[model samples]
Target: MDIKTAAAMHRLRLISLPEAVSFLLLLVCSVLKRTTDFDAVPVMGMVHGVLFVLYVLFWADAWNRTRWSPGRAAGYFVLSVLPTGGFFAERMLRRESEASVIAARARREGVVNA
Candidate 1:
């Protein structure tokens, strides 16, 4: 992938974990709000909302830059909604990024065709 695409992927990957954590925390806060005096739902809701927006923006950018197929793009979007999906998304993105880097290096060194 090109630098812009790579950067977009990196951004998405970086936000993925935090977003997931925020989502989980939000859920916990929601539960606590009902069961106890603890009520962090509003704060955590805002945090997760912002992160989720960022993730969507970055995801769109990556999709545009990489020209990913519709199915692939949809898969990523679906992952963003699931409770533990961001972790998996992050892992997948990391592997994809590493593979791209390796391929880029090989191509640069004349070990593979562009």
Candidate 2:
């Protein structure tokens, strides 16, 4: 993978973890609001929003670098709105990164030294 692809993949991986955590916290805040009228919703919502935006940005960057198909790109984009979807995104990215590493290693092996 090129540097841009690598960077985008790395950022996407790191961002997804925090995004997932924020989503989980937002869910907890919603439940707490119902049970105790706590006001954590706004804070959690803002956090989730920021993280969601970051996820989208990174996802787009990676998709562009990797030239992902429409269906695959859409799947990643759509998952952000669903509860607990960030976890799925993280897992998917990790798998993609692993696959990229393997492919790059193969290419390196196939290249004959001058």
For model 1, what is the error of residue 6's alpha carbon versus the real structure, in angstroms, after optimal superposition?
Answer: 1.1
Tell me how candidate 1 scores on lDDT.
0.92
lDDT of each: 0.92, 0.87
In order of listing, the candidates' clash counts read 0, 0
Best by lDDT: 1
- State in Å the error of residue 80, model 1: 0.6
Cα RMSD for candidates in order:
1.7, 3.1
Stretches of candidate 1 off by over 4 Å are none
Question: Number of the top candidate by TM-score?
Answer: 1
lDDT of 2 by residue, 1-114 (tens): 887898898898889889888988899999999999687999899999998999999998989998999999898887777777778888998899898888888888895436
> Could you tell me every candidate's TM-score relative to the true structure?
0.94, 0.89
Error of 1 at 48 (Å): 0.6
Error of 2 at 34 (Å): 2.1
User: What local lDDT score does residue 13 receive in model 2, on the 0 to 100 scale?
Assistant: 84
Model 2 scores worst on lDDT over the 10 consecutive residues at 105-114
Q: How many backbone clashes does candidate 2 have?
A: 0
lDDT (10s digit) by residue, model 1, range 1-114: 788889999999999999889989998999999999998998999999999999999999898988889999999999999988899999999998999999989888889554
